[model samples]
Target: MIKIAVVGCGQIAQRWLRVLTAHPKVSVTALVDTDLAAARRLHALGQVDAVTATTVHQALALANVEAIVNLTPPAAEPEMTRLGLTLGLHVLAEKPLTVRAAPAQALIAHAEQVGRRLMVMRNRAFDPGYSAFVRSVAGRGPLLAAGETFVQLRAPGFRTAHTALADLGVHAIEQARRLTDAPVIAVRCTEHPAAHLAPHAGLVTLLLEFADETVVSWRGGYAGPGLRTPANGRWSADTATGSATFDGQRQLRVGDEMVELEPAAPGYELCIGDMLAVLTGGSITPASVSATDHATSISVLEAATLSLSTGDRIQLAGTR
Candidate 1:
C-alpha cells in the first residue's frame, strides 16, 4: 500500500479525505494543518491509525508517509511542495498551485530532477460533463470566442490580493484552453475589487487572446453584483460549426443536445483518485495534470494581476 499524508485541513481536504479513505491501495497515514484541532478533527473521522501534526515538517518527522497530498493554500504551495520533494516524497498539489508563475515553473523542474511525481489537480479535464463539448469543439474548426463566469459568497480567505483569480480563474483558463488546440498568448484585464461593498477582493474581468486567434472573456470573484447564475459558474463557447455551454452542475448543452450528466464524483475526488491510481500502478488513459500547462494558466492570471495594476494588455512570454 502507498502510505500518504494529507497536508491541509480546509474545505477541500475533507473532500480528498473522503476519496482517499475509500481507496484500497492507499493508506491515510498522517494528517497535518497549522490548526492542530482541525487536523485532529479530520483524523477522528478518517478511521485510520494516523498521526496528526500541526505542520508538514512535524508530520514528516513523526510518520513514515511515502507521499504527500498538498491541500494547502496557493501562497503556501511552493514552500510546502519544495519541503515534500526535499524529503523524497511524491506530491499531488491542489490547484491554483501558486501565486507566482516563476516559482511554480521552478518547482516543476525541481520535481523532475528529484524523480518524484509532481501532479497538479487539473480537475476540469477529468469531468465527464465536458465530453460532449469536447466532441463538438473537435468537430468544429477552431475556437473563435468563449466566456466564463464564476461567483460565490464572500467566504473566509477571499480577502487576499488576487486570491479569486488564482483560485477559480485558473480553472477557467484551463477549461478555455481545453476547448481547442490553441495556446493562450496574451491577456488584457480589469479588476473591480468593490471594496466598499465587501471585505474580499471582488470581480475581475479579463480578455484572453489565444494562438488560434480565439478570444475568451472571463469573470470570477467572491461576491459581485449582477453577474451570477442559478449555478456557481457557467461558460459558453462558439466555433465555426456549433456552440457549447456548461452550467457548472456537470451539465452542458453542446449544439442543441441538452445533456445533463449524473452526479459524477466532484472534480476534487476524481483528481485525487487519478493521483492514487498512478501510485498503485494503474493509469488514467491520458494524464490529467501537466506542470507546463499549469504554468501557462498561472502566468495568464499573473498577467491579469499585473494588468490590474498597469491598466494594459500583458503578453505571455513563450509558454511552450
Candidate 2:
C-alpha cells in the first residue's frame, strides 16, 4: 500500500479523505492541519486510524509517509508541496497550484530535480460528462468557446474580487484550454459589482485568446440570487465541423446528436484512482493535470487578474 499523509482538514480535504480511506491500495497514515482538532475530527470521521499533527514536520516524524495529499489553501500549497518534494515524497495538490505562475513553475522545476511526481487536482477533467464532451470535440478545430457559472456563495473574508477568478473560475479556464487544446496567449477581464455579495466580490467575465486563434468567453460569479448553476457550469464550443455543448448535468449535445454519457463516480474518486494508478507505474496521459500543465492554467488566471486590475489585455509569453 502507498502510505500517504493528508495535509489540511478543510472541506476539500474531507472529500479527498473519503477517496483515500476507501481505496484498497492506499493508506492514510497521518492528517496535518493547523487546527489539530480539525485533523482529529477527520481522522475519526474517516476511521483511518491515522495520527494527527498540527504541522507537516510533526506528521512526518510520526508516520512513514511516501506521498502527500495537499489540500491546503492556495497560499499554503506551494510551501507544503515544496516541502513534500524536498522530503522525497510525491505530492497531489488542490488547484490554482499556487496563486501565480512563477512560483508554480518553480515548484515544477523542484519536483523534476527531486525525481518526484507533482500533480494538481483538475478534477473536472476526470468527470465523465466533461470527458465525453472533450472526446466529442476532438479533431474538430474549435473556433469559439463560452462558459457560464452562477451560484450563490457566502463570501469569505479572504475571497476578493481579484482572487475570485482563480478561486472559482479556474475550472472554466482549464476546461476552455482543454476544449481548444491550445495555449492562452492573451486575456482581457472585467468585473461588475454584485449587490448581493461583499464589496470585494463581483461578477467576473474574461475573454481568453489562445495561440491557435480560438477565443473563449467566460463569465461567473457568486451572486446567483434565485438561479444557481451546476458546480461544473455550462460549457459550449463552436468548431469547424459543428457545435458542442455540455449542460453541466452529464448531458452533451453535439450538433443534432446527443452524446451518451455513462454515469461515473465523483470527480474526487476518479482523480484519486488515476493518481494511484500513476504511483503504481502507470503512464500519465496528456489529459492528466501534471504540475507543468497546471502552471499554464495558473498563468492564464494570473494574467486575467492583472487584466482585471489594469483594464488592459494582458499578453502572455511562450505562447508560441
Candidate 3:
C-alpha cells in the first residue's frame, strides 16, 4: 500500500479523504493544514486513521509517507508541490498548477530532477459524461466549439473579479483544448462586474483560437441566478459532417442520435484510482493529462489574463 499525506483540510480535502481512505492501495498516513485544528477535526471524523500536522515537514516527521495529495489553493500549489518533490515524494495536486506557466514548468523540471511523479488532477476529464462527449467528437475535423457555465456561487474570501477566469474558466478552457486536435494559438478575454454577487466576484467570457483553425468561445460566471448551468456547463461542437452537444449532465446529443450517460463514481475517486494505477507501474494513457499539457493549459490561462488587461488578443509563443 502507498502511504500518503493529505495536505489541506478544507472541503475538497475532506472529499479526497473519503475516496483515499476507501481505496485499497492507499493509506492515509497524515493530514496537513495550516490550521492544525482543522486537520484534527478531519481526523476526528473517524473515517481516516492518521496524524495531524500544520505543515508537510511536520507530517513527514510524524509519518512515513510515500506520496502527497496536494489540496491547497492555487497560490500555494507551487511551493507545496516543490517541497514534496524535494522531499522525495510523489505529488498529486489540484488544478491551475500555478497561475503562471513559467513556475509550473519549473516545478515540472524539479520533479523530473527528483525522479518523482508530479501530476495535476484533471477530475473533469474522468467524468463519464465528459469522457463520452470527448470520445464522440474524436477524429472529427477542426471544429467550432462553444461553452457556457453560469452558477450562483458564494464567493470565497480569497476570490476576486480578477481571479474569476483562473478559478472558474480554467475547466472550460481545458475542456476546449481536449476537444480540439490543435494548440491554442491566441486568447482573448473580457470581464464584467456583477453587482448582485460579492464585491470580488463577476463574469468572464473567453475566446480561444487553435492552430488547426478550431475556435472556442466560453462564458462563465458566479452571478447568474436562474441562468445557472450544471457544474461542467453546456457544451457544443460542430464539424463539417454534424454537431454534438453535452448538456453537462447525463445526456449527450451527437447529430440525430442521443447517447444516455450513466452516472459513475465521483471524478476524484476515478482520478485517484488512475494515479494509483500509474504509481503501481501501469502505463499512462492519453486520458491522463500530462505535466506538459498542464503547463499548456496554464499558458492559455495566463494569456487570457493578459488579454483581459490589454483588451487585445494575446498570442502564445509556442505550444508547450
Best by lDDT: 3
Could you tally the backbone clashes for each prediction?
A: 0, 0, 0
Model 3's alpha-carbon lDDT is 0.83
TM-scores of the candidates in the order shown: 0.90, 0.92, 0.94
Q: Name the Cα RMSD for model 3.
A: 1.7
Candidate 2 whole-model C-alpha lDDT, 0 to 1: 0.81
For candidate 1, write residues 1-320 as lDDT tens digits.
99999998877787888888898998888999998998998877776789999977788788889999988876677899999998899998888777678888889898888988888888875556654456656746656655556565556552464566776677777776676666677888776665665666477777888776777787777665566543325767788777878776767788888887676666666777777878788464235666667877888778887887899988886442
- Top-down lDDT ranking: 3, 2, 1
CA deviation > 4 Å runs, candidate 2: 155-161, 193-195, 198-201, 318-320
> TM-score: which candidate is best?
3
The Cα local distance difference test for each model comes to 0.75, 0.81, 0.83
For candidate 3, the 10 contiguous residues with the lowest summed lDDT are 280-289
Error of 1 at 252 (Å): 2.7
Worst 10 residues of 1 by lDDT: 224-233
Model 1 misplacement above 4 A:
158-161, 224-232, 282-286, 317-320
lDDT of 3 at 19: 76
Rank by TM-score, descending? Answer: 3, 2, 1
Worst 10 residues of 2 by lDDT: 155-164
